[model samples]
Target: MPKSLVNYRVRHAFLVSYLLIVCTAAVLGASQLQTDPGSITVRFIIFGVIALILMVVGAIMGAVSKKRSASDIGEWNYRKSLLSIREYEKVLGRHEEDFKVFYDDTSSAGGCCCTISAAYLLYLALGIIPEGGIDASFWFTPAATLFIIIGYALLGLTSYGIGQHSVTFGVGDFFVAPDYRGLKHAKMLEDEEALYVKSLVKIGTQDDLQALFETEWRVYLDGQPDTVYIQLKVDKAHIYDYPYLVGIIVNGPDVVERTENLDIDTRFPGIVEYMSDEGVSVLVSRFDIPSDSAELEHEPNITAQEFRKLAKALARRLIKLSTE
Candidate 1:
């Protein structure tokens, strides 16, 4: 599963908006107390305004998430894209493995909860000494009530959003996995844990990766936020071409097909757009078995040094596309 970065980010954005509303409301309430002190209208009007603004911002972010990618976020450029990979047992009870955890922000919930609690305490203190106050609890009672009402509201919204995103990311992993199970090829793509991390690429935090057919796909992301992993649904039946060596920009699905050809939906944003804009193409041939077993050779006609040189060329291309 790809990191639920998009949903997490949306949830995080919603949390920030909630915070803004809380802080703004708290400050306004304090100001009102200093002036007239008895007025309760400030909570409604100012908060209403803030809510409106947040709604507008949310709409814009929705558009961005739907149309653009997560890499556009300035903070994401230098950070690692994905945090960890989880097995189905670690996540939902999926039967397969190969999905990864992309993004999560449950950590932020603790911060929000603490902030709400502190704000309530602060308001309670100020209200305890309010004018015309008689009973001690009576003075602080309004403050506590106000803060709890607002605080719980904010905290609840944030928590729900966070959970919703977590569930969304978890489920999406399975959606693509069915298309990919038992489809990966090439021994070089495996990581130390043999998890095959590089096969997945992320375009941005907005959209999730669509699972195409299983094939040999190489991923090249170095955890820079500016880099968004573009995802495309690979067809169940198609050939593909990928970079292997420097000068050998195009390689064979030769183990199977007569010619290497990569067919990606260039009309879309993520990988296809990035590849088209950069003139990069990944080629794969049909996975047909060669009748002559002896002729089914997979080695390239190049020396070790030459192979390294060829790989460097593709590496440079990958780096450029990755950053772009």
Candidate 2:
């Protein structure tokens, strides 16, 4: 399924159905007025004008306000955007100005009021004083009853649509701005991945591998809050068999690094591939040292405390390497 890059939203069903109900009421009232020659009165005009004003106000509300929260993952997939921390911050900063809020998800109170008032007005307009005077036969008429029911249902639906955040813009979903940052992250990730692969391939000696490690750390340390942090994990149960420690990716181009770096040469002497000694019952038997790249920003198993510990350890290692 194609995804939306912009924040344009509309409620066409609510708008179109609302207009239809108003038109139908008008047409039916006009027919009744024509049938009863002396029934066209000032009260009828007032009701018509008021209903028109309410409809217009509803239309404006739907047009200007956003229907969903900015953080809605289904509508705005921030994770898939693969934006750097800095770029993600920019997107969040612009959210308030970009999407104006009028009614929230719990606006059902207003909807209830609207539904009640519409139903009552519909009953009065189509029943008791349809024009200026009422006919005995039309007082308990089925036509008025039908119109009231239909009008109530239509108004209820329109109000519900306005009050909730489920309505989507359908075709207008793709009408986002060309320069949306989310749309550009894929290209940026691609370029970064290329650079990462090149760096990995260039390690020929232990000194070169150390240089790559320092370079990657230096790049992240320089970027500070904007850096994309990656976490590599080893199941606690299999940690002993894995040889190398579960660690963070100090440097990688994209958010995920899938490439294998298991070549145990002079440049990566201790990087071994191990088979779990846990017999045939083990689900994952083979393990790569410095494991395949971490898939997410942080592995779920590593807690905040564990992260701080690992970070301090890495900092010590970096300092030692720098002094050497």
Candidate 3:
């Protein structure tokens, strides 16, 4: 596992602050040189304008960083070997009660306070926050105070957002392994892991349990809050009526193939969406648990272990059908 999420947040705070200061200084100097280029009295006017733009841009980048990418994929696959689904499933089991032990829900707010405090100190050093009351003339005091308050708040919030993003980007490191034991049922997409993981859902059956012992369809999750998905590594176009077949198998032989693409029905059986990347077709299906949590839960009627058994069976059947 990687360092505690807090460590990443702390590092992110310092990194962001340092860059902000350096970039702001550089931009302010360039702007000054290009414009009046002389009197360096207060410079608060230029500093405020440059700082606002930089912080806004930084916040936007922080938001984008939350979206996962091929490069962000984790050390396990960062030139590392792949492990089977069974092995990962075993890892899942080991951490069943404490899987979150490796995760910190509060890490998102990490560095928020530090960022705010640092901003305060930075303002003091710049004479923006003087020992006496307002640092500016009577006419400019209100505007300056308001701008400073808003800017300071943005700094804190941006830091928090960035820390949260780091956690999102790096959380997968705690859940890495590669194999396709559960691919046929859904399609995988590039950067699909960018989607937040609300919870892990498994929906296999029992009779095909033994078959899973041999099949090789990789399993992964995607989508976000309120929607769960499974991604598999295969050219789904090769499979005829892929969505219809899965719906029938999981929903029942009575399931109908609609004139349009399949959808998650009132029962939430599952829906299939498709995409292709680099010639590899990927499928997205809705076999995910419908909750915003890391803990796994089944239909109120079934036990958790029973739910895993069902998921395994579903995987086996889907793989067998794909081979045929």
- TM-scores for every predicted model: 0.26, 0.28, 0.27
- Per-residue CA lDDT of candidate 3, range 1-324, in tens? 223222456446555664666455554444553444233344454445555455555555554544322133222212222344444455345443332423435454546646644774465345343436434343233354344445544663565355445444454444333223233232322123332111133322222111011223333322221212233322222221122222112222222223223332333344444443443333344333334333434332323233233333434433443333
| Candidate RMSDs in order | 18.8, 16.8, 15.6
- Residue pairs clashing in model 2 are none
lDDT of each: 0.34, 0.35, 0.38
The residue-by-residue lDDT of candidate 2 on 1-324, one tens digit each, is 111323333445545656666666556554554454334353344244534454445544443343432223233221123334354345433442333232123335566556656764764465436446456355334554455345434553454445344334333422232222222222232223211110111111121111100011111222223222222222333332221122222232222222223322222222212122222111111233344335324333333333333333433333332332
Query: What is the lDDT for 32 in model 3?
Result: 52
Roughly what TM-score does model 1 have, to 2 decimal places? Answer: 0.26
Deviation from native of the Cα of residue 164 in model 2, angstroms: 9.7
Deviating ranges (above 4 Å) for candidate 2: 1-17, 25-88, 95-219, 222-307, 313-324
Ranking of candidates on TM-score, top first:
2, 3, 1
Q: Give lDDT for model 2.
A: 0.35
Question: Model 1 residue 56 lDDT?
Answer: 38
Error of 1 at 29 (Å): 4.2
**What does candidate 1's lDDT look like per residue over 1-324, in tens digits?**
334323456646655665565566556644553453343443333234433343334334433432222322222211122312333122222323323333333356456546644644444434444445334343234564465346434543444343343232332232343324322322223332212233332322223333222322333334423232212123322232222321111221112112322232222111111122233334221223333445535522223333223233334444453443
> Positional deviation of 142 in candidate 2, in angstroms?
14
lDDT of 1 at 185: 24
Where model 3 places Cα greater than 4 Å from the true spot, the runs are 4-48, 56-147, 155-324
